[model samples]
Target: MVRESLKILLTSCFLLLFLASCTLGGGKNGKLLKSTGQPYEVVLEGDTDSIVTKILTEEVPALPQPEPLCRLIQVKKGKIHGSYLLVRTRIVVNIPAAEFSVGLSRNENASPQTVIRISARSPQQLREKLNPEKLRQLVDEAELEHLASIISTNPSKQNREMQQLVKKNFGISMNIPAEMQASKKAKNFIWISNNASSGMKNLILMKMKEVKSEKRAEEVNSEERRVKKTDAFSAQEKQQIDSMLRTNMPGETDSMYMVIPVLAKRGLWEMKGDAMGGPYVMQRIRRGKTGDEIIIIGFVYAPEMKKKILIKQLEAAISTIK
Candidate 1:
Protein backbone atom coordinates (compact mmCIF):
# COMPACT_ATOMS: atom_id res chain seq x y z
CA MET A 1 0.00 0.00 0.00
CA VAL A 2 2.81 2.39 0.83
CA ARG A 3 4.56 1.69 -2.44
CA GLU A 4 1.39 2.23 -4.41
CA SER A 5 0.76 5.47 -2.58
CA LEU A 6 4.27 6.70 -3.37
CA LYS A 7 3.82 5.91 -7.02
CA ILE A 8 0.61 7.94 -7.26
CA LEU A 9 2.10 10.89 -5.38
CA LEU A 10 5.24 11.01 -7.53
CA THR A 11 3.27 10.81 -10.76
CA SER A 12 0.92 13.59 -9.74
CA CYS A 13 3.76 15.86 -8.67
CA PHE A 14 5.63 15.33 -11.92
CA LEU A 15 2.52 16.01 -13.97
CA LEU A 16 1.83 19.24 -12.10
CA LEU A 17 5.38 20.45 -12.51
CA PHE A 18 5.23 19.80 -16.24
CA LEU A 19 1.94 21.63 -16.64
CA ALA A 20 3.15 24.63 -14.63
CA SER A 21 6.35 24.91 -16.63
CA CYS A 22 4.48 24.78 -19.89
CA THR A 23 1.94 27.43 -18.94
CA LEU A 24 4.01 30.12 -17.20
CA GLY A 25 5.82 32.86 -19.12
CA GLY A 26 9.62 33.15 -18.75
CA GLY A 27 10.25 36.56 -17.09
CA LYS A 28 7.18 36.26 -14.87
CA ASN A 29 8.37 32.89 -13.66
CA GLY A 30 11.67 34.36 -12.47
CA LYS A 31 10.19 37.59 -11.14
CA LEU A 32 10.62 38.39 -7.46
CA LEU A 33 7.99 36.27 -5.75
CA LYS A 34 5.88 37.72 -2.96
CA SER A 35 4.00 35.50 -0.54
CA THR A 36 0.24 36.02 -0.72
CA GLY A 37 -2.49 35.50 1.86
CA GLN A 38 -2.01 35.41 5.64
CA PRO A 39 0.82 33.40 7.17
CA TYR A 40 -0.11 29.85 8.22
CA GLU A 41 -3.32 30.24 6.27
CA VAL A 42 -3.84 26.86 4.59
CA VAL A 43 -5.79 26.41 1.40
CA LEU A 44 -7.49 23.17 2.37
CA GLU A 45 -9.08 21.43 -0.65
CA GLY A 46 -10.70 18.30 0.72
CA ASP A 47 -13.88 16.90 2.14
CA THR A 48 -15.01 18.41 5.42
CA ASP A 49 -14.40 15.16 7.35
CA SER A 50 -11.35 14.05 5.35
CA ILE A 51 -8.44 12.55 7.23
CA VAL A 52 -6.15 15.35 6.10
CA THR A 53 -8.46 17.94 7.61
CA LYS A 54 -8.87 15.94 10.81
CA ILE A 55 -5.13 15.59 11.34
CA LEU A 56 -4.28 19.20 10.52
CA THR A 57 -7.01 20.54 12.80
CA GLU A 58 -6.37 18.14 15.68
CA GLU A 59 -5.88 19.61 19.17
CA VAL A 60 -2.24 19.33 20.22
CA PRO A 61 -2.14 18.70 23.98
CA ALA A 62 1.43 17.49 24.32
CA LEU A 63 3.01 20.91 24.69
CA PRO A 64 3.86 22.36 28.09
CA GLN A 65 0.25 23.35 27.51
CA PRO A 66 -2.59 22.46 25.12
CA GLU A 67 -3.65 24.34 21.96
CA PRO A 68 -5.01 23.38 18.59
CA LEU A 69 -2.40 22.59 15.96
CA CYS A 70 -3.88 25.33 13.79
CA ARG A 71 -3.73 27.82 16.66
CA LEU A 72 -0.08 27.13 17.29
CA ILE A 73 0.68 27.89 13.65
CA GLN A 74 -1.91 30.67 13.57
CA VAL A 75 -3.44 28.77 10.65
CA LYS A 76 -6.51 30.28 9.13
CA LYS A 77 -8.54 28.02 6.83
CA GLY A 78 -8.93 29.67 3.46
CA LYS A 79 -11.75 29.34 0.97
CA ILE A 80 -12.27 25.68 0.05
CA HIS A 81 -11.38 24.85 -3.53
CA GLY A 82 -12.39 21.18 -3.19
CA SER A 83 -10.07 19.75 -5.83
CA TYR A 84 -6.70 18.02 -5.79
CA LEU A 85 -6.22 18.72 -9.49
CA LEU A 86 -5.10 22.27 -8.68
CA VAL A 87 -1.58 21.32 -7.69
CA ARG A 88 0.15 23.92 -9.90
CA THR A 89 -0.06 26.66 -7.25
CA ARG A 90 1.40 27.97 -4.02
CA ILE A 91 1.00 26.44 -0.55
CA VAL A 92 -2.06 24.25 -1.08
CA VAL A 93 -3.36 20.84 -0.05
CA ASN A 94 -5.17 18.69 -2.57
CA ILE A 95 -7.14 15.64 -1.45
CA PRO A 96 -7.78 13.30 -4.33
CA ALA A 97 -9.60 9.97 -4.51
CA ALA A 98 -6.90 7.32 -4.19
CA GLU A 99 -5.51 4.79 -1.73
CA PHE A 100 -3.33 6.42 0.91
CA SER A 101 -0.95 8.82 -0.82
CA VAL A 102 0.80 11.87 0.61
CA GLY A 103 3.70 13.95 -0.72
CA LEU A 104 5.02 17.52 -0.86
CA SER A 105 5.87 19.07 -4.22
CA ARG A 106 7.83 22.25 -4.96
CA ASN A 107 8.36 24.62 -7.94
CA GLU A 108 5.06 23.55 -9.41
CA ASN A 109 4.42 27.07 -10.73
CA ALA A 110 6.37 29.85 -8.99
CA SER A 111 9.99 29.78 -7.86
CA PRO A 112 9.12 29.17 -4.19
CA GLN A 113 5.82 27.35 -4.30
CA THR A 114 4.66 24.23 -2.44
CA VAL A 115 1.83 21.78 -2.79
CA ILE A 116 0.88 19.08 -0.30
CA ARG A 117 -1.08 16.26 -1.90
CA ILE A 118 -2.95 13.69 0.19
CA SER A 119 -5.20 10.94 -1.09
CA ALA A 120 -6.83 7.69 -0.12
CA ARG A 121 -9.42 5.29 -1.49
CA SER A 122 -11.62 6.63 1.26
CA PRO A 123 -11.35 8.75 4.39
CA GLN A 124 -11.96 5.69 6.58
CA GLN A 125 -9.09 3.81 4.97
CA LEU A 126 -6.78 6.76 5.52
CA ARG A 127 -7.72 7.01 9.20
CA GLU A 128 -7.25 3.25 9.72
CA LYS A 129 -3.83 3.10 8.08
CA LEU A 130 -2.39 6.42 9.16
CA ASN A 131 -0.51 7.44 12.29
CA PRO A 132 -1.92 10.69 13.66
CA GLU A 133 1.38 11.67 15.22
CA LYS A 134 3.22 11.33 11.90
CA LEU A 135 0.54 13.27 10.13
CA ARG A 136 0.88 16.07 12.69
CA GLN A 137 4.63 16.08 12.08
CA LEU A 138 4.09 16.33 8.34
CA VAL A 139 2.03 19.49 8.79
CA ASP A 140 4.75 21.09 10.90
CA GLU A 141 7.46 20.18 8.39
CA ALA A 142 5.44 21.64 5.53
CA GLU A 143 4.82 24.80 7.56
CA LEU A 144 8.57 25.38 7.95
CA GLU A 145 9.10 24.97 4.25
CA HIS A 146 6.28 27.38 3.53
CA LEU A 147 7.81 29.94 5.88
CA ALA A 148 11.30 29.58 4.41
CA SER A 149 9.92 29.97 0.93
CA ILE A 150 8.17 33.17 1.91
CA ILE A 151 11.38 34.60 3.32
CA SER A 152 13.33 33.54 0.26
CA THR A 153 10.86 35.14 -2.12
CA ASN A 154 10.81 38.34 -0.06
CA PRO A 155 14.35 38.53 1.17
CA SER A 156 15.27 40.94 3.97
CA LYS A 157 18.76 42.34 4.22
CA GLN A 158 20.47 41.23 7.44
CA ASN A 159 20.88 44.01 9.95
CA ARG A 160 24.53 43.36 10.87
CA GLU A 161 24.71 46.21 13.40
CA MET A 162 21.52 45.02 15.12
CA GLN A 163 22.82 41.47 15.01
CA GLN A 164 26.01 42.57 16.73
CA LEU A 165 24.05 44.49 19.32
CA VAL A 166 21.92 41.46 20.15
CA LYS A 167 24.99 39.22 20.37
CA LYS A 168 26.77 41.70 22.58
CA ASN A 169 23.77 42.27 24.83
CA PHE A 170 21.85 38.98 24.73
CA GLY A 171 24.62 36.49 23.77
CA ILE A 172 22.47 35.21 20.90
CA SER A 173 22.83 35.34 17.12
CA MET A 174 19.72 35.59 14.96
CA ASN A 175 18.63 37.57 11.90
CA ILE A 176 16.60 40.73 12.24
CA PRO A 177 15.48 43.26 9.63
CA ALA A 178 17.82 46.12 8.89
CA GLU A 179 15.08 48.57 9.76
CA MET A 180 13.99 46.89 12.98
CA GLN A 181 15.50 48.61 16.02
CA ALA A 182 15.59 47.75 19.67
CA SER A 183 12.93 49.71 21.51
CA LYS A 184 13.81 48.41 24.93
CA LYS A 185 16.94 46.75 26.32
CA ALA A 186 17.84 45.39 29.71
CA LYS A 187 20.52 43.15 31.15
CA ASN A 188 18.63 39.96 30.24
CA PHE A 189 15.74 41.19 28.12
CA ILE A 190 15.41 42.98 24.75
CA TRP A 191 12.41 44.04 22.67
CA ILE A 192 12.95 44.54 18.95
CA SER A 193 10.23 45.79 16.64
CA ASN A 194 9.87 46.73 12.97
CA ASN A 195 8.44 50.11 12.00
CA ALA A 196 5.48 49.20 9.86
CA SER A 197 2.62 51.65 9.60
CA SER A 198 -0.05 48.97 9.20
CA GLY A 199 1.05 46.78 12.07
CA MET A 200 3.98 46.15 14.36
CA LYS A 201 6.01 42.91 14.30
CA ASN A 202 7.91 42.42 17.52
CA LEU A 203 10.23 39.88 19.12
CA ILE A 204 11.19 39.61 22.78
CA LEU A 205 14.23 37.72 24.04
CA MET A 206 14.60 36.89 27.72
CA LYS A 207 17.40 34.86 29.27
CA MET A 208 17.28 33.58 32.80
CA LYS A 209 19.24 31.26 35.05
CA GLU A 210 17.79 27.78 35.00
CA VAL A 211 17.39 26.33 38.45
CA LYS A 212 19.84 23.50 39.06
CA SER A 213 18.78 20.19 40.57
CA GLU A 214 20.46 16.83 40.92
CA LYS A 215 17.38 15.03 39.59
CA ARG A 216 17.06 17.37 36.60
CA ALA A 217 20.76 17.06 35.80
CA GLU A 218 20.65 13.30 36.02
CA GLU A 219 17.57 12.92 33.84
CA VAL A 220 18.40 11.68 30.32
CA ASN A 221 17.80 14.51 27.85
CA SER A 222 15.75 12.52 25.40
CA GLU A 223 12.95 14.06 23.31
CA GLU A 224 10.36 12.85 25.81
CA ARG A 225 12.30 14.22 28.75
CA ARG A 226 12.87 17.52 26.99
CA VAL A 227 9.12 17.87 26.39
CA LYS A 228 8.39 17.15 30.05
CA LYS A 229 10.94 19.71 31.15
CA THR A 230 9.49 22.29 28.83
CA ASP A 231 5.99 21.58 30.14
CA ALA A 232 7.16 22.12 33.70
CA PHE A 233 9.16 25.22 32.83
CA SER A 234 6.34 26.70 30.74
CA ALA A 235 4.43 27.77 33.85
CA GLN A 236 7.46 29.41 35.36
CA GLU A 237 8.22 31.14 32.08
CA LYS A 238 4.68 32.52 31.88
CA GLN A 239 4.96 34.05 35.31
CA GLN A 240 8.23 35.65 34.39
CA ILE A 241 6.74 36.92 31.13
CA ASP A 242 3.78 38.47 32.94
CA SER A 243 6.08 40.27 35.30
CA MET A 244 8.33 41.43 32.49
CA LEU A 245 5.46 42.70 30.40
CA ARG A 246 3.94 44.49 33.30
CA THR A 247 7.16 46.27 34.02
CA ASN A 248 8.70 46.70 30.57
CA MET A 249 5.94 46.29 28.00
CA PRO A 250 3.68 48.99 29.32
CA GLY A 251 0.44 49.68 27.48
CA GLU A 252 -0.99 53.10 26.49
CA THR A 253 -2.07 53.69 30.09
CA ASP A 254 -0.73 52.75 33.50
CA SER A 255 -3.64 50.38 34.16
CA MET A 256 -3.07 48.44 30.92
CA TYR A 257 -0.73 45.45 31.08
CA MET A 258 -0.05 42.16 29.30
CA VAL A 259 -1.10 38.92 30.92
CA ILE A 260 -0.49 35.29 29.93
CA PRO A 261 -3.66 33.26 30.03
CA VAL A 262 -3.83 30.21 32.34
CA LEU A 263 -2.58 26.88 30.91
CA ALA A 264 -1.98 28.49 27.53
CA LYS A 265 1.22 28.43 25.50
CA ARG A 266 -0.30 30.96 23.10
CA GLY A 267 -3.14 33.49 23.22
CA LEU A 268 -4.39 36.97 22.32
CA TRP A 269 -3.25 39.76 24.63
CA GLU A 270 -5.18 42.95 25.20
CA MET A 271 -4.30 46.16 26.95
CA LYS A 272 -6.68 46.41 29.90
CA GLY A 273 -7.38 50.14 29.65
CA ASP A 274 -6.76 50.41 25.92
CA ALA A 275 -8.38 48.82 22.87
CA MET A 276 -5.23 47.14 21.46
CA GLY A 277 -4.27 43.48 21.25
CA GLY A 278 -3.02 40.67 19.02
CA PRO A 279 -1.78 37.09 18.97
CA TYR A 280 1.36 35.74 20.64
CA VAL A 281 3.40 32.51 20.89
CA MET A 282 6.00 31.70 23.53
CA GLN A 283 8.70 29.03 23.47
CA ARG A 284 11.59 28.08 25.79
CA ILE A 285 14.92 26.43 25.05
CA ARG A 286 17.99 25.57 27.12
CA ARG A 287 20.79 27.88 26.05
CA GLY A 288 24.01 26.53 27.50
CA LYS A 289 25.71 24.39 30.17
CA THR A 290 25.92 27.45 32.43
CA GLY A 291 22.34 26.72 33.57
CA ASP A 292 20.94 29.44 31.32
CA GLU A 293 17.61 29.17 29.50
CA ILE A 294 16.21 31.34 26.71
CA ILE A 295 12.59 32.36 26.50
CA ILE A 296 11.53 33.62 23.04
CA ILE A 297 8.26 35.46 22.59
CA GLY A 298 6.84 36.66 19.25
CA PHE A 299 3.76 38.83 19.10
CA VAL A 300 1.66 41.02 16.81
CA TYR A 301 -0.07 44.35 17.58
CA ALA A 302 -2.12 45.27 14.53
CA PRO A 303 -5.54 46.36 15.76
CA GLU A 304 -7.27 46.27 12.34
CA MET A 305 -4.80 44.09 10.51
CA LYS A 306 -4.45 40.35 9.90
CA LYS A 307 -1.65 39.18 12.22
CA LYS A 308 -0.84 35.64 11.12
CA ILE A 309 1.56 36.72 8.38
CA LEU A 310 3.50 39.18 10.54
CA ILE A 311 3.66 36.74 13.45
CA LYS A 312 4.95 34.14 11.02
CA GLN A 313 7.54 36.59 9.74
CA LEU A 314 8.73 37.19 13.31
CA GLU A 315 8.91 33.40 13.80
CA ALA A 316 10.91 32.93 10.60
CA ALA A 317 13.32 35.68 11.55
CA ILE A 318 13.89 34.18 15.02
CA SER A 319 14.35 30.67 13.53
CA THR A 320 17.70 31.89 12.18
CA ILE A 321 19.22 31.07 15.59
CA LYS A 322 22.48 29.33 14.92
Candidate 2:
Protein backbone atom coordinates (compact mmCIF):
# COMPACT_ATOMS: atom_id res chain seq x y z
CA MET A 1 0.00 0.00 0.00
CA VAL A 2 2.87 2.40 0.75
CA ARG A 3 4.47 1.71 -2.65
CA GLU A 4 1.17 2.25 -4.49
CA SER A 5 0.63 5.63 -2.74
CA LEU A 6 4.13 6.83 -3.71
CA LYS A 7 3.57 5.80 -7.37
CA ILE A 8 0.27 7.72 -7.52
CA LEU A 9 1.88 10.89 -6.10
CA LEU A 10 4.70 10.74 -8.65
CA THR A 11 2.24 10.31 -11.52
CA SER A 12 0.22 13.37 -10.40
CA CYS A 13 3.31 15.50 -10.11
CA PHE A 14 4.49 14.55 -13.58
CA LEU A 15 1.12 15.30 -15.10
CA LEU A 16 0.95 18.70 -13.39
CA LEU A 17 4.42 19.67 -14.63
CA PHE A 18 3.61 18.66 -18.22
CA LEU A 19 0.40 20.71 -18.17
CA ALA A 20 2.18 23.75 -16.79
CA SER A 21 4.86 23.57 -19.47
CA CYS A 22 2.30 23.30 -22.23
CA THR A 23 0.41 26.33 -20.88
CA LEU A 24 3.59 28.37 -20.75
CA GLY A 25 4.45 27.34 -24.30
CA GLY A 26 1.16 28.83 -25.45
CA GLY A 27 -1.11 25.75 -25.57
CA LYS A 28 -1.29 21.99 -25.33
CA ASN A 29 -0.35 21.80 -29.04
CA GLY A 30 3.00 23.43 -28.20
CA LYS A 31 2.57 26.17 -30.80
CA LEU A 32 2.11 29.89 -30.36
CA LEU A 33 -0.99 31.48 -31.82
CA LYS A 34 -0.23 33.94 -34.61
CA SER A 35 -0.52 37.55 -33.52
CA THR A 36 -3.67 39.37 -34.63
CA GLY A 37 -4.59 42.96 -35.71
CA GLN A 38 -3.31 45.15 -38.54
CA PRO A 39 0.19 46.60 -38.62
CA TYR A 40 0.77 49.61 -36.29
CA GLU A 41 -2.31 48.63 -34.32
CA VAL A 42 -1.69 48.23 -30.58
CA VAL A 43 -3.74 47.01 -27.62
CA LEU A 44 -3.44 49.43 -24.69
CA GLU A 45 -4.32 48.38 -21.16
CA GLY A 46 -4.32 49.85 -17.65
CA ASP A 47 -4.67 53.56 -16.86
CA THR A 48 -6.45 55.10 -19.83
CA ASP A 49 -5.88 58.69 -18.74
CA SER A 50 -2.13 58.29 -18.72
CA ILE A 51 0.33 59.78 -21.24
CA VAL A 52 0.71 56.33 -22.78
CA THR A 53 -2.59 56.61 -24.60
CA LYS A 54 -1.92 60.19 -25.60
CA ILE A 55 1.44 59.35 -27.14
CA LEU A 56 0.13 56.29 -28.95
CA THR A 57 -2.81 58.19 -30.44
CA GLU A 58 -1.03 61.48 -31.04
CA GLU A 59 -1.22 62.86 -34.59
CA VAL A 60 1.90 62.40 -36.64
CA PRO A 61 3.47 65.82 -37.16
CA ALA A 62 3.73 67.63 -40.55
CA LEU A 63 1.31 65.37 -42.38
CA PRO A 64 -1.32 66.75 -44.77
CA GLN A 65 -4.02 65.74 -42.32
CA PRO A 66 -4.42 64.32 -38.86
CA GLU A 67 -3.32 60.71 -38.53
CA PRO A 68 -2.37 58.88 -35.34
CA LEU A 69 1.03 57.25 -35.12
CA CYS A 70 -0.62 54.07 -33.86
CA ARG A 71 -4.14 52.75 -33.78
CA LEU A 72 -5.05 51.82 -30.21
CA ILE A 73 -7.72 49.53 -28.69
CA GLN A 74 -8.04 49.98 -24.97
CA VAL A 75 -8.70 47.09 -22.58
CA LYS A 76 -8.89 46.62 -18.84
CA LYS A 77 -6.22 44.54 -17.10
CA GLY A 78 -8.69 41.73 -16.33
CA LYS A 79 -9.70 41.55 -20.00
CA ILE A 80 -6.14 40.97 -21.34
CA HIS A 81 -6.14 37.19 -20.93
CA GLY A 82 -7.77 35.53 -23.93
CA SER A 83 -7.76 36.87 -27.51
CA TYR A 84 -6.08 40.09 -26.39
CA LEU A 85 -2.96 38.07 -25.65
CA LEU A 86 -2.60 37.52 -29.40
CA VAL A 87 -2.29 41.17 -30.30
CA ARG A 88 0.91 42.06 -32.17
CA THR A 89 1.77 44.95 -29.83
CA ARG A 90 0.53 45.98 -26.40
CA ILE A 91 1.24 48.61 -23.74
CA VAL A 92 0.27 48.31 -20.08
CA VAL A 93 0.68 51.07 -17.52
CA ASN A 94 0.33 51.86 -13.80
CA ILE A 95 0.88 48.39 -12.39
CA PRO A 96 1.72 48.47 -8.66
CA ALA A 97 5.43 48.23 -7.81
CA ALA A 98 8.01 49.53 -5.34
CA GLU A 99 9.36 52.13 -7.76
CA PHE A 100 8.71 53.43 -11.25
CA SER A 101 9.98 51.13 -13.94
CA VAL A 102 9.27 49.97 -17.47
CA GLY A 103 9.65 46.43 -18.81
CA LEU A 104 9.39 44.78 -22.19
CA SER A 105 8.67 41.17 -23.19
CA ARG A 106 8.48 39.48 -26.55
CA ASN A 107 6.39 36.47 -27.62
CA GLU A 108 5.07 36.01 -24.09
CA ASN A 109 1.69 34.63 -25.07
CA ALA A 110 1.85 34.64 -28.87
CA SER A 111 4.44 34.75 -31.61
CA PRO A 112 5.59 38.11 -33.06
CA GLN A 113 4.33 39.90 -29.99
CA THR A 114 5.69 42.96 -28.09
CA VAL A 115 4.39 43.75 -24.63
CA ILE A 116 5.52 46.82 -22.67
CA ARG A 117 4.61 47.23 -19.04
CA ILE A 118 5.08 50.29 -16.83
CA SER A 119 5.05 50.00 -13.06
CA ALA A 120 5.24 52.46 -10.20
CA ARG A 121 4.38 52.79 -6.50
CA SER A 122 1.59 55.20 -7.39
CA PRO A 123 -0.20 56.53 -10.45
CA GLN A 124 1.34 59.93 -9.92
CA GLN A 125 4.83 58.52 -9.95
CA LEU A 126 4.10 56.58 -13.11
CA ARG A 127 2.96 59.75 -14.89
CA GLU A 128 5.83 61.86 -13.58
CA LYS A 129 8.64 59.50 -14.46
CA LEU A 130 7.39 58.25 -17.81
CA ASN A 131 9.23 59.72 -20.80
CA PRO A 132 6.77 60.19 -23.65
CA GLU A 133 9.45 60.22 -26.34
CA LYS A 134 11.00 57.02 -25.01
CA LEU A 135 7.63 55.30 -25.07
CA ARG A 136 7.07 56.49 -28.65
CA GLN A 137 10.46 55.16 -29.71
CA LEU A 138 9.73 51.76 -28.16
CA VAL A 139 6.35 51.57 -29.89
CA ASP A 140 7.89 52.56 -33.23
CA GLU A 141 10.59 49.87 -32.93
CA ALA A 142 7.99 47.22 -32.12
CA GLU A 143 5.85 48.17 -35.12
CA LEU A 144 8.87 48.14 -37.41
CA GLU A 145 9.84 44.67 -36.18
CA HIS A 146 6.32 43.45 -36.86
CA LEU A 147 6.50 44.90 -40.38
CA ALA A 148 9.91 43.36 -41.08
CA SER A 149 8.66 39.93 -39.95
CA ILE A 150 5.70 40.14 -42.28
CA ILE A 151 7.93 40.99 -45.23
CA SER A 152 10.58 38.39 -44.44
CA THR A 153 8.20 35.44 -43.88
CA ASN A 154 6.14 35.82 -47.05
CA PRO A 155 8.52 35.21 -49.95
CA SER A 156 5.62 35.07 -52.38
CA LYS A 157 4.75 38.64 -51.43
CA GLN A 158 8.20 40.01 -52.22
CA ASN A 159 9.84 40.69 -55.57
CA ARG A 160 13.15 38.88 -55.33
CA GLU A 161 14.31 39.70 -58.86
CA MET A 162 13.93 43.43 -58.31
CA GLN A 163 15.66 43.15 -54.95
CA GLN A 164 18.57 41.33 -56.55
CA LEU A 165 18.77 43.96 -59.27
CA VAL A 166 18.95 46.65 -56.61
CA LYS A 167 21.77 44.74 -54.95
CA LYS A 168 23.62 44.45 -58.25
CA ASN A 169 23.36 48.14 -59.08
CA PHE A 170 23.53 49.88 -55.67
CA GLY A 171 25.12 47.09 -53.63
CA ILE A 172 22.21 47.41 -51.17
CA SER A 173 19.45 44.91 -50.42
CA MET A 174 15.83 46.04 -50.29
CA ASN A 175 12.65 44.00 -50.02
CA ILE A 176 10.37 45.08 -52.84
CA PRO A 177 6.92 43.52 -53.03
CA ALA A 178 6.07 41.33 -56.05
CA GLU A 179 3.12 43.58 -56.77
CA MET A 180 5.49 46.41 -57.75
CA GLN A 181 6.75 45.80 -61.26
CA ALA A 182 9.80 47.53 -62.67
CA SER A 183 8.18 50.27 -64.74
CA LYS A 184 11.37 52.01 -65.80
CA LYS A 185 15.11 51.58 -65.43
CA ALA A 186 17.90 53.93 -66.47
CA LYS A 187 21.53 54.57 -65.67
CA ASN A 188 21.64 54.29 -61.87
CA PHE A 189 17.84 54.72 -61.54
CA ILE A 190 14.88 52.35 -61.24
CA TRP A 191 11.16 53.02 -60.92
CA ILE A 192 8.88 50.30 -59.54
CA SER A 193 5.13 50.54 -59.18
CA ASN A 194 2.01 48.47 -58.39
CA ASN A 195 0.06 50.26 -61.23
CA ALA A 196 -3.30 49.70 -59.50
CA SER A 197 -6.36 51.41 -60.95
CA SER A 198 -7.92 52.50 -57.66
CA GLY A 199 -4.63 53.59 -56.15
CA MET A 200 -0.98 53.25 -57.05
CA LYS A 201 2.18 52.78 -54.99
CA ASN A 202 5.51 53.87 -56.42
CA LEU A 203 9.14 53.54 -55.42
CA ILE A 204 12.15 55.20 -56.97
CA LEU A 205 15.79 54.32 -56.52
CA MET A 206 18.64 56.51 -57.70
CA LYS A 207 22.38 56.44 -57.19
CA MET A 208 24.19 59.78 -57.15
CA LYS A 209 27.61 61.07 -56.21
CA GLU A 210 27.78 62.62 -52.76
CA VAL A 211 28.59 66.35 -52.91
CA LYS A 212 30.37 68.11 -50.05
CA SER A 213 28.56 71.37 -50.85
CA GLU A 214 25.16 69.76 -50.24
CA LYS A 215 26.35 68.41 -46.90
CA ARG A 216 27.59 71.85 -45.85
CA ALA A 217 24.30 73.45 -46.92
CA GLU A 218 22.33 70.96 -44.84
CA GLU A 219 24.47 71.70 -41.80
CA VAL A 220 24.06 75.44 -42.27
CA ASN A 221 20.28 75.09 -42.62
CA SER A 222 20.14 72.93 -39.51
CA GLU A 223 21.96 75.58 -37.48
CA GLU A 224 19.90 78.49 -38.83
CA ARG A 225 16.46 76.98 -38.30
CA ARG A 226 14.80 78.11 -35.06
CA VAL A 227 11.89 75.67 -35.31
CA LYS A 228 11.82 72.29 -33.61
CA LYS A 229 13.48 69.39 -35.43
CA THR A 230 11.09 67.77 -37.89
CA ASP A 231 11.03 66.19 -41.34
CA ALA A 232 9.83 69.43 -42.91
CA PHE A 233 12.10 70.84 -45.59
CA SER A 234 13.63 74.30 -45.70
CA ALA A 235 13.02 76.52 -48.74
CA GLN A 236 16.49 76.07 -50.19
CA GLU A 237 16.49 72.34 -49.43
CA LYS A 238 13.10 71.96 -51.11
CA GLN A 239 14.32 73.65 -54.28
CA GLN A 240 17.39 71.43 -54.46
CA ILE A 241 15.40 68.23 -53.90
CA ASP A 242 12.74 69.31 -56.37
CA SER A 243 15.33 69.96 -59.06
CA MET A 244 16.77 66.52 -58.55
CA LEU A 245 13.33 64.94 -58.72
CA ARG A 246 12.44 66.79 -61.95
CA THR A 247 15.65 65.73 -63.65
CA ASN A 248 15.02 62.07 -62.84
CA MET A 249 11.24 61.61 -62.46
CA PRO A 250 9.77 63.22 -65.57
CA GLY A 251 6.08 63.08 -66.44
CA GLU A 252 4.49 61.80 -69.66
CA THR A 253 4.69 65.22 -71.33
CA ASP A 254 7.89 67.13 -72.13
CA SER A 255 6.69 70.16 -70.16
CA MET A 256 5.68 68.21 -67.06
CA TYR A 257 7.98 66.94 -64.35
CA MET A 258 8.08 65.95 -60.67
CA VAL A 259 8.51 68.82 -58.24
CA ILE A 260 8.06 69.46 -54.55
CA PRO A 261 5.73 72.47 -54.52
CA VAL A 262 6.57 75.56 -52.50
CA LEU A 263 3.29 75.18 -50.60
CA ALA A 264 3.67 71.43 -50.35
CA LYS A 265 3.27 69.99 -46.91
CA ARG A 266 5.89 67.68 -45.48
CA GLY A 267 6.10 64.39 -47.40
CA LEU A 268 3.98 65.72 -50.25
CA TRP A 269 5.00 65.50 -53.93
CA GLU A 270 3.31 66.93 -56.98
CA MET A 271 3.77 66.70 -60.72
CA LYS A 272 4.40 70.06 -62.36
CA GLY A 273 1.90 71.12 -65.09
CA ASP A 274 -0.26 68.13 -64.07
CA ALA A 275 -3.02 67.47 -61.56
CA MET A 276 -1.32 64.39 -60.04
CA GLY A 277 -0.05 64.73 -56.49
CA GLY A 278 0.38 62.55 -53.40
CA PRO A 279 2.43 61.77 -50.28
CA TYR A 280 6.10 60.90 -50.59
CA VAL A 281 9.01 59.90 -48.34
CA MET A 282 12.64 60.31 -49.37
CA GLN A 283 15.84 59.02 -47.78
CA ARG A 284 19.45 59.49 -48.88
CA ILE A 285 21.94 57.00 -47.48
CA ARG A 286 25.64 56.49 -48.19
CA ARG A 287 26.42 53.51 -50.40
CA GLY A 288 28.68 51.31 -48.31
CA LYS A 289 32.14 52.94 -48.09
CA THR A 290 31.79 54.56 -51.49
CA GLY A 291 31.29 58.29 -52.15
CA ASP A 292 27.95 57.62 -53.87
CA GLU A 293 24.56 58.07 -52.16
CA ILE A 294 21.45 55.98 -52.73
CA ILE A 295 18.21 57.96 -52.90
CA ILE A 296 15.01 56.07 -52.09
CA ILE A 297 11.62 57.70 -52.51
CA GLY A 298 8.28 56.01 -51.80
CA PHE A 299 5.08 57.73 -52.90
CA VAL A 300 1.39 56.92 -52.99
CA TYR A 301 -1.38 58.13 -55.36
CA ALA A 302 -4.50 57.15 -53.44
CA PRO A 303 -6.92 60.04 -53.73
CA GLU A 304 -10.01 58.20 -52.59
CA MET A 305 -8.66 55.88 -49.91
CA LYS A 306 -7.13 56.69 -46.53
CA LYS A 307 -3.35 57.07 -47.00
CA LYS A 308 -2.02 56.71 -43.46
CA ILE A 309 -1.66 52.95 -43.59
CA LEU A 310 -0.53 52.91 -47.20
CA ILE A 311 2.31 55.38 -46.56
CA LYS A 312 3.37 53.39 -43.50
CA GLN A 313 3.51 50.18 -45.54
CA LEU A 314 5.67 51.93 -48.10
CA GLU A 315 7.92 53.17 -45.30
CA ALA A 316 8.32 49.56 -44.13
CA ALA A 317 9.38 48.48 -47.58
CA ILE A 318 11.88 51.30 -47.77
CA SER A 319 13.24 50.36 -44.32
CA THR A 320 14.51 47.05 -45.71
CA ILE A 321 17.59 48.95 -46.91
CA LYS A 322 20.65 46.88 -46.01
lDDT of 1 by residue, 87-150 (tens): 2232333333646776777654444445666666665776776677876666555565566444
Return the clash pairs for model 2, or none. Answer: none
Residue 31 lDDT, candidate 2, scale 0-100? 68
lDDT of 2 by residue, 12-72 (tens): 9999987776563375457676788887888898865656887778886545668888888
Q: What is the C-alpha RMSD of each candidate to the true structure, in Å?
A: 11.4, 6.6
Q: After superposing candidate 2 on the true structure, give the runs of residues whose Cα lies further than 4 Å from its correct spot.
A: 1-29, 213-241, 261-266
Number of the top-ranking candidate, with TM-score as the measure: 2
TM-score of each: 0.64, 0.79
